[model samples]
Target: MSAETASTRLAEIHSRIARAAQIADRRPDDVTLIAVSKTHDAESIQPLIDAGQRVFGENRVQEAAAKWPALKAATPDIRLHLVGQLQSNKAADAVALFDAIHSVDRLSLVAALAKAMAESGKRPDCFIQVNIGDEPQKGGVAVRELPALLAEARAAGLPIVGLMAVPPVGVDPAPYFALLAKLGREVGLTELSIGMSDDFEVAVTIGATHVRVGTALFGARA
Candidate 1:
């Protein structure tokens, strides 16, 4: 998309977010819009950057490492967030590249992240991913295991910021969002990283602090 198109899209999404926040009695600034740039390359992402979008989310640490360094060098204010399942083996790279990790679901990953943070001296903000739908195929920690995981993360010195979840598809998401918000509060976490392209507005209404918007911001990926 052209720079103008990107800027227009961003403005539109921001307007929607602002309206949603207003309706929810929350400041628009309280909810961050992370343009998920996973499959998109740096060339395609630059227009969004030019449009003043500084926070982007990526799925893979390797892809982010390959794409962000030069983009970040040119635009020093950009923040990269890892919004996909994280492998224990990639912890070091993820720590070095991402400003926040939203898929910390297992104890092994937490331990790896802790060690990586210690070795690299870079502590990325963490979000405990809960498999809210209890989907066997997903990567988030089960609700039953959240307390222990939260304690483990804190004890390991990871900066546990909040919770993240992807509700089941083709269903009303308000309840899931509400559940995440409730879980976040119960765990003493304020940042609820719940929401995506389709449900982000609902997420904001239900108290999402971060929304990972992709297709809406950057048209359907090829």
Candidate 2:
């Protein structure tokens, strides 16, 4: 996409976000838009960066490692987030690369992150992803197991920031987003990392502090 197109798309999404925030009586700035640049290469991503998007999300550490170092070196304020399921063995790399991790869902990964943080002295904020829809293939801690996961994350000294969830596809997502928000509050987590391109406005109404928007901002991926 061209810089002008990217800028227009970014502005449109921001306008929608502002409208959503207003409807919910929340400040638009409270919601961070994480432009998920997972499969898109550097050439495709730089246009968005040029459009003044400072925060980006990637699904894999390897993909991020390949593209971000050069980008970050040029624009020092850029923040990268790991918004995909992470393996325990990649904890060190994730800690070193991402400013926030939004898919921490298991004890083993928690332990790995803790050790990596200790060794590297880098602690990225963490979000406990809950399988709110209880989907078998998704990478989130089941709803019943959330409290224990939160406790373990805290005990491990991980900076547990909030909860993240992806509602079941082809279903109304409002309930799942509301559930994730409720769960976040119950656990004393104020940050709700819910919503995406299609349903972020609804998520804002339900108190999402972070929206992972990919397609809307970057256009449909190839």
Candidate 3:
């Protein structure tokens, strides 16, 4: 996409977000828009960056490490987030590369992240991913196990900031979204990493502090 195309896409999504936030009686600025650049390379992502997008999400630690260093060096404030399942093996690399991590789902990952943080002295914000719909294929911890994971994460100094979830597809996501919000509140977490290109507006209305938007911003993947 051209710079203009990227800027236009950003504006359209922001407008939708602002409208949704207004309906929720919340400020649009409160909801951080993370342009998910999972498969897109620097050349493809540069237009969005040139259009003033500072925050992006990537799926893999290695891909982000390869793509973001130069981009971040040029724009010191660009924040990268890990929005995909995190492997314990990549904990150290993820800690060093991402400004925030949204896939912290298990005790092992929490321990890995804590050890990485201690070794590198870098504490990236973390959101516990909840398998809110009880989907066995998803990357989050089951809802019944959230408390244990939260306790362990907090105990390990993992900067447990909020909850992240991807509701089951092809369903009325409002209930799932509301449930995620309630779960976050129950755990005393104020932030929420819910929503994506399709259901993000519904998510914003339900109090999503962060929305990971890819197709809406970068167009469909090949």
Q: Worst lDDT window (10 residues) for model 2?
A: 177-186
List TM-score per model, in order. Answer: 0.99, 0.99, 0.99
Instruction: Write down the worst ten-residue block by lDDT for model 1.
Output: 179-188
Tens digits of per-residue lDDT, candidate 1, 89-166, equal 999999988899999999999999999999999988999999999999998999999999999999999999999999
Candidate 1 ranges with C-alpha deviation above 4 Å: none
Question: Model 2: per-residue lDDT, tens digit, 1-222?
Answer: 999999999999999999999999999999999999999999999999999999999999999999999999999999999999999999999999999999999999999999999999998999999999999999999999999999999999999999999999999999999899889889999999989999999999999999999999888888
> Local distance difference test, per candidate?
0.95, 0.95, 0.95
Span of ten consecutive residues with least summed lDDT in model 3: 130-139
Pairs in clash, predicted candidate 1 = none
Candidate 2: C-alpha lDDT: 0.95
Q: Please, what are the lDDT tens digits per residue for candidate 3 over residues 130-180? A: 999998889999998999999999999989899999999999999999999
Give each model's clash number. 0, 0, 0
